[model samples]
Target chain A: MINDVWILATASLVAISCALVGVFLILRRQALMGDAISHSVLLGIVLAFLISESRSLPVMLAGAVIIGLITAWLSDTLHKVGKLQSDASIGIVFTLFFAIGVILISLYAGQVDLDQECVLYGEIAFVPFDTIIWGSSEQGLDIGPRAFWMISVVFVIVLASILVAFNRLQTVAFHPSLALSLGINVVFWHYFLMTLVSLTTVASFDAVGAILVVALLVIPASSAYLLASTLKNMLWLAVIYAQSAVLIGYALAYALDSAISASIAVTSGVLLGLTILGLQVHKIRLRRQGKATLLEKA
Target chain B: MQEWNLIQQPGTWELLIEFWSFEDMNALWVLMGSILLGMSASVIGGFAFLRKRSLIGDALAHAALPGVMMAFLLFQTRDPLVMFLGALTSSFIGFFLIDWLPKNTKIKPDTALAITLSFFFALGLMLLSHIQGLQVENKSGLDKILFGQAAAMTQQDITLLAYVTVFILVAVTAFFQKFRLIAFSAIYARSLGVPVALYELLLALLIVMSVVVGLQLVGVVLMAAVLLTPIAAARFWSDQLTTILFLSAFFGALSALISTQISYLAPAMPTGPWMVVSLASLFLLSLLFAPSRGLIKRYWQQRQLRQKVSEENVLRTLYKLYERRQFEQNDFNIADIQALRSMPTDMLKDTLKHLCKKQMIRESMRGFCLSKEGLEIATQLTRRHRLWENYLNQYMDLPADQVHSQAERIEHILTQEQEWQLEAELKNRKSDPHGNPIPENTEGMSRDK
Candidate 1:
């Protein structure tokens, strides 16, 4: 029972990292980029595992980041030169690359430690077994699974990096021309942010499957976008929504004895649904108040 | 060693012949079905595109996921009929939410689409995992539907598609006038006693139907392409109602066949991407060589216009030289006019012929001179130039000489109302500071030029 808390904490931490990075992705309107990157990362993860003969964290991260860069670069190039629309270019790149990844997986994945089932569904249950300890000079506290450590370190880096660059990032997301005119190094920063989003996503892949990984990256931030007026407020709301969703969803899954991550995803969805419904109710109340003023004037 | 290899290897040429025959048959079926899907989607997408609701298809495709899972949960099977019905239900509700949310709430459509897309896809994932845990018999069918497996399509798919195709054809034809009028001019359509709301609802329903039918072949991600590609490809061909409809059908038919053939050839590839490739190729071809709108044709037409503009500039320069006493003789030949402008000999001769046809300039043995009509036109043009310069200098606060360069582009597009406003603003200046006379306004000057 006590160990269950650790798992929950770990899962929530993973969710938080996705939500944190998602804030900017949603603001920049790169929501579907998450979906494209998720599918394309399969090629990277497979190549990394093949070369390393194991799931080396740094190697896998590097591979996934490379795939992310490829997806972004391919989409941008097609849009610029081929004169295709942004969404169409994104669709073309992901479908073709993902098909190649599918073929590769079908041919070579048969003999490896990986399988299509792991690729699509993911396996968070087995994460606790893959572990490492660090800085345990004292007899009591030690580190846990390498994924836990990876996500923890990543969370700190993402939070600190975003905190420092918040002003510039917000400016670029809203007023790209203004940011460029003011010497924001807009091109480098865009790629830098894409890299961070890719790293955070690959880090969360072990806990959540690819599709739900996409769900986390877009939903909470979009929900916050609806509920807030300013970028600062939106980011704060997004963090709250991401964590609260994890907690509520974990409890519901525990009660129902269902999968933890899947339930949390549905809970995030339900939260957005309820927010929409609440907004409807508020509109009706406001309309009623307006009608009352008209009646008084009459 | 070569002889031994030949003996060991079976001839793939004979095998290839057999494969090609089988592929031809399969490609025909795929093409027929793609035609059905493409035509219906375009007809439906036409309304959506006209209404600027193209992204609605995208939103609804994502919205259908959870509904599909819920249908599976209820039916306990991956039956196409049940799943599609369920998907349609949730997708409609998703649109209802998206539509209702903005009117009643603070959330915009972008956020609405983003949330619904993520939420429904997430819920579907949860339901998918649940279905897996229960060890459902047709679990693999779920995976096939997600990414699309066009090869596994059997006789049943063809039959269902044929039925839907007929329904869409009859329905669109029956409502053609109403749909067209509604698409072209909504207010006019309403005034004609058309059921505007019902027409819109039916349009949305058809779009959802097209999506559900194509989901088995294109999946959630690229179904919008199936809806968009044929129309986009056909847009290059013609704008006439009949031509657009027929050409879009043809394009859809062709794209589907190519995709289906590719899927058959490469068993590993999905039908959705093959379909996209064919659609993209059609659009690329259209961009290069479509009759009216192709890049090549536009470029050629622009070259003709530039030739005319350059000729006019030279003739105007010659006219200026005559005004400055360079060509003191009242009549001069084309060769003398060409020398004054320093233009190429043959090109100037060709342009001079075109000008003589327009009656703007005429040729004598001595040189070229402006016609009486040409003088009035040139004087009007010159007056506009000086007047605009004055207007810009006074209103825009630019230097008097600096305003001349800016008016070069503005003189071409300035409307009469705008010119009048400019004249009023400049207080009807009779002469430019350059000492050029602002020609007097004359009757029929406005109509002639």
Candidate 2:
């Protein structure tokens, strides 16, 4: 029971952090940029491991953040300077970086502890095994799973950043030129959000892997975007949706004995589908009410 | 050190030789299969790229995963055909979801693509992990479809790959014109009474087939690269659709050859990444070095245009100075030239030197003077500038102040025929909107007197 709580906490932290940053990405039409950064961060992790000669968490995080920034910068450059289509540039940059990451892992398979499978779909099931012990030796306390701790810190950082810079991020996301006109630094906000995405991605890597991080980032925020009219409501709704997905997905994964992260992603998609259907039904009912009111007046 | 040992192995040379010699039947099959896959994927990917749906291929490839898992669970077999059908059905469903979500919901297309891709991939992962826990035979190689193990491809895999790729190629060839029509402009094709929806379905089916067959070689993660990079690279080399298609196929085949050779030589290296890395390299090369549209070529063209514009500006400035002096003196010093127009000293010197080298200007004790050829050219430029100014001020109803900058850019590119037409249209105007006298076209006339 405690293990399941830890797993749920870890998954919820991941979903919350990703969904918070993902709201800005979807608003800016940069959802795929989130996707690109997640894939390419694998190369950063591997390179950091190779360079630092250790799998220390900070070094890997630093490596992933740097590569994530570069992935964002390079794809933007390719679209602007190289004159490639934005989608094609995004595709090329991430795939090349990912290919390099895969090749390096295979080349130094013995030296590096990471593998392609682990990077693709992380072993979230093993999160409970890697615990962080806190306090003194005799009465040492288990501080839940290491992934939970990492993601908790990330979730706090992401939430605080969003709260602190809510208006700036909103203006930059919705109307960049207007933000610029109002003396806001659009580029600074862009990289600020990208850094948060990178940090969230690297932290969440243990729970959800790289590619599915995109699922967590995009799905809940998009669902919130459909229902919420304001940025604040969207943020709140997305977190709520993400938490619901975690709970339901955990139950589903437990019953099916399947991967928890994938189940969460699938659950979020189902929620979005349901949101779309409900909205459609609501629209139809309103139209019917309008017709009945006209007939009564006549 | 491990890499060094792999390279230094004595058998490496023989393996390369054997690979090229086709002595190993497995090597031959892998090579043939990759070549066909490369060609066919690039050809179909060209259409997707043209339609601005490059990443949809990525989504569909990921969407194929669950279908493959479902097929395995039901049939309890690893037959390529069953897996292909399962993947095909699921990918088509994914294709429709991607198409349907944006139209039916408030979700933008990019978000829709992201949702469909990741959701389906996650569901597939769930099924795959479930399958892994089962005690089934032939389940060991099931995970290979994620990253693709080219070396483990059996003859049956090769045959399936060959058949699917060939069918895709032939179908694409048979419907080339129709496909091209829809890809370029679907609304126009619809207006022409073309069944655009049917053709779009056909294209989607072809794309799904190529993507499914390629799962064993390029895998789901990087399959989109095989479908996109070659066509992107080929686009830099040509503008014609047929030429682009041919070039993209050629590039695809070439990358496949290079990657397959490397994979065969180094057993640990996977074919998919090598193939994608090589294709990316080719794309970078084409982006940098292809003629006309390549970055280097475009940069050079811009540089040349800058030089020409600056050079012409200097000549025109000198002519203006000469005209201001009532044609009394052709010789004007650098200081006199600078008084009329602002040019940096170094660039002015270089422009003067270039003009001298072209024999358009002559240096004397006073400073510089236009040679006969230079005077004629300057006269023609001045004439074109003034004529454009007059035309814009008259026909465009500009207030004369806005005409100079517009005339400045147009003077550089206005052809001789355009000059004649402008002169005729303006009825041989002698002065511009600014009341500056327009010089007559002095071609074939002696001005030395």
Candidate 3:
């Protein structure tokens, strides 16, 4: 029970971070990059582990950041120089980097147990053992694992970044050219946003891997976006959705005795589908009511 | 050791020689198929770019992943034929989901795509893992799809690629005019009795073709990149239909060649990455070097135009002041001319000298005045400005104050015929709404000029 609570807490923290970063990415139509970040994080972790010969958090995150940069750099190059559509550039760059990571894993199969399945669908069963300790065990209530600490810290970081940059971010999200005309560095803000997304993604990859990372990032944010107009409301709704998904998904997986990551992914996807349906019904009902009132006035 | 080094040690030419010696058939086949695939994808991508449906490729590519994986597990094989059919069916399904979600539900394409892509790919991942647990790994070829392993090109793949290309080409050519009309204006096309549904379906098929053809080269994840990048690169080259088609093909072929070369140089280098890099490099070059749209060309054009505008502004300002009885005598003083505007004395002197060389202005004792021809030109311009102001106020229902700015923009743009039509429409008003005299008609302002 304690172990389950610890894992549930870790999932919630990571989910919040992903949901937070996703709010703007979806608004800017850059949500797909979140999934790409998850896949490419494997490359970062592998390269970092190879260099440090240890699976430490710093080394792993350093690797993830570098891979994220490479992914972002390639996408930028494709967009600016290649003149490819932004989405196309993202699609091309991340998949290629992800493939490179796959080949690297295959080449160094002996040193690493990472496979394509693990890369695409991360295993949450092993997350509990990867604990973190700043000092003595005598200290009260250790923050569980390094992954938990990483995500909790990442959640706070993402939350702070979004809060600080929210206004400029909203302007860019709504109309990047308009933002540029206002002398705002649209590109600078965009890269900063991407950096935050990559960091949050890396923080989550240990628990959910690439595909689920997108499920966590995109679906809740999308549902929230569909239901709200204001960015502030959307962000809060997405956070709420993410936490709910984590809690519900953890409990459901516990009941089914299935792989937690995939169960969470499917549950969130279904929830998104349901939310979309629910919103539409609500809208139609409101429209009918509006018509009824108008008819009464007439 | 020489054989082991695929790129630096043994060049493509050498590889060709060795292949010919060994009678390697599969390599030749993959190369041929990739060329056909490359060409068709670019052609379709060009149209997609024009329509701004580039992201649809991103959506469809990811949507097809689960289908490919599910087919692999169910069929228990790595045959190109079955996997492609699986991909096509699934891509359509993805397309259906995108269209359906919006109409049946309120899901936007972006949100629907994101949802579908992740869900489908995750499902595929699960199926793939289950299959991976079995011995022989019947679909090991499936893993190569993520980034694409184009170098492992086989004869069978080439044949399939050729057939698909041919199939797409026939469909596109058969409805070329309809496609263009629909692409340019759907409402007009629909009103003109064109079957909007058929054309739209063709477009969806073309998008599916773009995705399915490159499954072996770029895979589901990056297929959209190949489908969009080439067209994007080509857009900078020409707006003409024929030229755009050729350039898109050129970019596509270049990407294929570069990706193939990369795969050759680095053994086990996946086809998708190589293709992406190749396409990216080609796109970059086009963006920098393409005529008219390139940064260097635009910058130079703007610089030259600025000089012309500054000169034109100085000449026009001087002539207008002379028309108001400010500087009519010979040997005009430059200081008085500078005082009329906020421009410096030296700048005003330079403008006076430039106008003198052009015989349009003469420096008088007081300041600057228009020469005979310059006076007529200035009168004509001022007359057109007020005429437009009068016309807008009387005919277009503009307020008196609003007509000045509206007429200002129109004066610089109206053609000779348009100006004459406006003159005729007002039936020769003696004075403008502002009570200024309208300029007399001149043979010089005839349609020929």
Using DockQ as the measure, which candidate wins? 2
User: How many clashes in each candidate?
Assistant: 4, 0, 17
The per-prediction CA RMSD against the true structure, in angstroms, equals 8.0, 2.9, 6.8
Tens-place lDDT per residue, model 2, B1-449, is 13423756788778888788878989999999999999999999999999999898899999999999999999999999999999999999999999998998888999989998998998899898888878889998788888777887889999999999999999999999999999999999999999999999999999999999999888898999999999999999998999999999998999889988887787667788988999999999999999979999999999999999989999999899989989989999999989888899999999999999998899987999999888888898898999999999889999889999999999999987788799899995789988899987675443222
Give all TM-scores, in the order shown: 0.73, 0.94, 0.74
Q: Candidate 1: give the clashing pairs.
A: B332-B366, B332-B367, B333-B366, B333-B367
After superposition, candidate 1 runs with Cα above 4 Å error: A1-10, A25-123, A126-154, A171-199, A202-209, A225-230, A250-260, A277-298, B1-31, B184-188, B236-245, B287-399, B410-433, B436-449
Lowest summed lDDT across 10 adjacent residues in model 3 chain B is found at B1-10
Q: Global lDDT for candidate 2?
A: 0.90
Across B291-386, the per-residue lDDT of candidate 1 in tens digits comes to: 987667878888987775665565445555566664365465765666666677888777778778888778766657777666655555556777
The runs of at least 3 residues in candidate 2 whose Cα sits more than 4 Å from the true structure, single-residue gaps closed, are: A1-5, A128-146, A284-298, B1-5, B444-449
Model no. 1, DockQ: 0.22
Q: Candidate 3: where are CA atoms >4 Å away? A: A1-9, A21-147, A160-199, A205-212, A223-263, A273-298, B1-24, B188-195, B292-301, B321-327, B330-338, B342-449
Clashes of 2: 0
Give the per-prediction TM-score of chain B: 0.73, 0.95, 0.80
